[model samples]
Structures are given as structure tokens and as C-alpha cells.
Target: MNKYIVKMLSVNDNNAFFQLINTNRERLEDFFAGTVLRTKTIADTINYCEEIEQKINKKSYFPYLILEKESNVIVGFIDVKNIDWNIPKAELGAFIDSKHEGKGIITTTMASLIDDIVNEHHFKKLLCRISSRNTRSIRVALNSGFELEGTIRCDYKTTKGEIVDLNYYGKIF
Candidate 1:
């Protein structure tokens, strides 16, 4: 496997991260629907990054930027959101640049972070809510050991405003 690194999203990563998102905007929108970002300019990306950074500081969300270790280029991201301290569970969302999609980067990165997410963050359950039509993402979640839980009907709206069902997958630590 190629070496990769996962770091908490930071102010310093704005440019690289923005470029990655902008380049993959269309592909990302296909799967992410409601969550896919549509950043038209650098300022928009900076604002988005700053919001995520604040959430990280407040412990309400954790968003990590994935990079190629050799070049330190932004390749993807995995985020843990909807953190519930009482239930000790969080939702996991991830995506990789289309160019890097088939290399197993996301699966490996998620596996690598499981330990830290469970031990350091104290999350008992990690959930992945994937669009039912997104086979690639479902495969990634399964490869990382997340089990199919159930389907959420009309869970989200697509970029084009179509309602879709979501496949829920979870990993219990």
C-alpha cells in the first residue's frame, strides 16, 4: 500500500484542500448530494474550512484531510460528524479524488484511523450513511469492516433535488 497520512483539517491546508474539492466537485456531488461541497472560489473554501476547524475545536465534529505521504498532496477526506457523547457514536463520511478512487486509499486510511477514533475519541460506534446507488463507497465501508445496518428511506436530496434512500453501515468497537 502507498503511504498516506490523515491530519485534522487546518487553516494551513486551505489552498490544497480547496483545489482538491474544486477539482472533484462534480463527482463528489453525485454521491454526497446534500453534503457535497460546491465551492466556486478560494474564499468559499476558506470559509468552509474555518467552520470545520471550529467544529473540531468544539469537539462536535472531526474532519481529517488525507494526503499522499510522499508528496503531501491532498487526496481525500474522512469526517466524523454528529458526535453524540451520550451514545458515543458518530457518523463517518468520506470521499477520494476520482483519480485516486481505485487505489484502496480510503479503505486503508479509514482502517488506520479506527484505533484513534475509538481510543482517543471514545466512540463506540462509527456509522457510514451511503447513497444506495454508490457501490464504490459501500464497498469501501465494508472493506473497512463496517457492517450493513439498514436503509434510511428518502434520507437525502441529491444535487438535482431528487430524494434517495441511504444505506447505513456501522462498525461497533
Candidate 2:
């Protein structure tokens, strides 16, 4: 198994985070539209990290970074946002650096993180809304124990300005 260190996204990670997105820009553009658009430079990343830190403090958004254990490089990100505390559920989003694709990093990290999200946050369910065309992400979701629920029509807009359908998958705790 690939070793990793997962932790909350901290403001201190701005540089590494920016580099991760910079290197994976093309591959992340579609699924991570907002992130790809917001983190165009180190300055932008610093600002974004500050905002995310505030949200984390408010318990409104949870963003976690996955680092390669040996090198301490930021290789993947997982977000639990759109949290509805009444139902205690949140939306799940994730992306891995292109170079780390096919390495099972996301599947393993996400599975372990899901357990923590449930135990620490009291989240009842987690949903992943994946672009319909993104087979890689769908595979990761399924491998991480999510079930396909349904297709959401025109669920997301890409940074390139195209509206796309999404496949909704869910995992109940």
C-alpha cells in the first residue's frame, strides 16, 4: 500500500498546494473548476488558503490534504463541503496529482478519511457528485465504498464554460 499523511488544509500549505494545482491544472480543470480558477498563482493560493482556513474554523467547509509520506509533497486533496449539520451529511470532492494517478492513493486515503469524518464530525452520509464522463473518479468513489444513486442533469459547469451532467454517488454511515 502507498503510505500517506492526511491532515486538514492549513494556511502554511499554500506553496505546496499551489504547486500541486499548478502541475495538475489541465487534468483538474474540469472536476475542480473553482479550485483551478481560484488558484492561478502563489498569491492567489495564499489568499485562497486563508479563506479556506476561515471556513474550516467556522466548521462550514472541511478540506484535507494528502501528502506523500516520504517526500511530504502534496499529492491529493479531499473536501467535505456543503455540509448540512441537521442531516449531518456533506458533499465529497477529491483530486489527485496526475503523476499519482493509478496508484490507489485516493481510494486508500479516502476510505480512511471517511471513517474519521464520521467519527469526528458526526456526519451521517457522504455524497460524491462526479462528472458523468470521469470514469477514474467514479472508480475511486466505488472503491471507497460509495454507491451510485442517480444522475443529476447539468449538475456542474466547467471552467471552460460547459455545463455537464453528474453521476451522484452516496455512502451512508
Candidate 3:
């Protein structure tokens, strides 16, 4: 019944964007332990913001910053990636502040992002890949109307020199 999501439309709040990514990087590092996903330094984070800015400029990606209402802090974010106009499919990615894990913040944020993107964008399908070991992410995808497609065996290099399989999920717009 309350608004739990807001897109990063105005560029006036540069601090907000940096703050969100800086505070959650550690949690992201852990969540994506098997992959090189986190921004280890401020420069990297800045570069990321710049990259996101470029993506937005090109209309190739749309990102949203998720703010937890009571706390007024960005506890998580959901992004639509790999947007392909021809295929009408976009890859999905999400992250939540570790402190807020197990809560439904990501779900709420996801619902909001999906609704807006579906209404504004013409993409016909959404695609998501979840590390096989990350059950929480898989659950979120399944609960959010995503259907499990198949498992890709030994598809990626994870941390500690381990290979991980990824489960694919898809949904129609």
C-alpha cells in the first residue's frame, strides 16, 4: 500500500547514488563471492556510476534505486540488463543490503521496477540467471512470476577456484 521503489530519474542526488553503492558493496561482494561483482574501491564504484550513466544515455539500461521507506536508505536495487530490442528480452539483476536480507524489500522493489518497466518499455520477456547455490535469489525470481528454464552446468568461475552452475529463469512481459 506504500511506495517502496523510486527510479533514479533526477541527477541532483549524486550523493544518494554513491551512498547506496558504497554501503552495499561489501554485502554484494559476499553475495557474489564466486564472481568479480563488487566495486572494491571508490574509483571502481565511480566508474560503475559512469558506466550506468552511459547505459542510461544510450537507453540500453534503466536502473532504479530502492529506498526503504521507514529508514529512508537505499537497501537494495533491481536492474534490467542486456536489453535486446530484437529478442525483446532483458536480463535481470538485483542486490539487497546484507543487513536487510531475508526481508521482502527486494521483492517489493522488484515488483515496482517490473511494473514500471513493463508499462514504459516494450520488452516482451525478462530473463534471469541465479547461481545454483543462491536459493534466496532463486526463490525471489520464482515468486516474482519467473519460471525456471534449465540449469547450465559449470558455466562460471566462482571464487576459491570453484566452478558454479547457474539456473536460468524467464518470464513473458
Candidate 4:
């Protein structure tokens, strides 16, 4: 396993948060399609950080930054968004730094997060939605014990200018 750690986001981590967004903008755009991030400047990251702070404070959404143990630099992220505490489920998404791709960072972070959420928070399941065309992402999902349930067509618009489908994967605890 990699020498990395995952922790919850804090309001005071402003600089670190911004750096993660700035540093991974291109990688994010590549993994996440239909991003209007090209038009948004760094100020956009500032605003997003503010918004995320409020959400974390309220417990409605949970986000984490992945840090390399040696450098303490954020090299990836794992987000469990739109959580319904009563429902015991969350929408999961993650991406490692492009330079660090294929290093099992996302997999380790995800497995660790799921263990925490299920054991500490009593979560019953974690679900992920991956664009069908993204074989790499789908591989991560499957590698982390997520089972393919189904697909939603036209779920997202790709960078290549086509509406693509998404596959739903789930892991039950």
C-alpha cells in the first residue's frame, strides 16, 4: 500500500484546499466531463471552498483530501456527497493526481473511507456512478468491491462533445 492518509476537510484548510483544486483542475476536467471550469478562475475555487465549508459544517456532505504521508500534499480526493444519513448511503467519487494514476491511491483511500463510514457512521452502503466510457474509473470501482448494478444513459456530456452513459456500482457493508 502507498504511504498516504485521508482525512476530513476543515474550514481552516483554505490554502491547502485551493491548492488541491488548482493543482488538479486539468486532471479533474479529464476525469469529470461537462465541467465549465475552463471559464472559472481561481476565484471560482475560493468560492467553492467557501460553499463546501458550510456543507461540511452542516454534515449534509462529506469531502476529504488525500495527502501523501511524506510530502503532506494533496494528491487525490474522495468525496461522499448528497448523503442521506437516514438512508445510510452516499454517492462516492474519487480521482488521483494524473501523475500518480495507476498507483492504487484511490483504491486505498476508498477502502479506508468505507471502513470508517460503515463502522463509525453506521453506513449500510456506498454507491458510485462512473461514466460508462471511462474504463479506468470503472476498474477502480470494481477493484474496491463495488458491483455493477446498472447504467443510466446520457448521464453526462463528455469532453469529446457527446452525451455519455453512466454505470451504477454499489458496495454493501
Who wins the TM-score comparison?
2
Candidate 1 residue-wise lDDT, 1-173, digit = tens: 55899999887787888788778888877565433463567887778778778888899989888999999998999888889999899998999988898999999999888888899988889999998998999999999999999999999887788899999999998
Model 3, position 39, has a per-residue lDDT of 45
For candidate 3, lDDT tens digit of each residue in 1-173?
75465666334434565566667655555434521253455555556667777888887987677886776767667777789988777988888777778988787778767877878787799988888989899989998999999999988775555788999999997
Would you list the clashing residue pairs of candidate 1? none
TM-score, prediction 3: 0.83
Q: What does candidate 4 score in Cα RMSD to the true structure?
A: 2.6
Question: Which pairs of residues collide in candidate 4?
Answer: none
TM-score of each prediction: 0.93, 0.96, 0.83, 0.86
Superposed by TM-score, candidate 3 places the C-alpha of residue 104 at a distance from the truth, in angstroms, of 0.8
Candidate 1: C-alpha lDDT:
0.86
Clashing pairs in 2: none
Candidate 2: segments with Cα more than 4 A from true spot: none
List lDDT for all candidates, in order: 0.86, 0.92, 0.73, 0.78
Model 2: lDDT of residue 40: 98
lDDT-superior candidate, 3 or 4:
4
> Which regions of candidate 3 are displaced past 4 Å?
9-19, 30-38
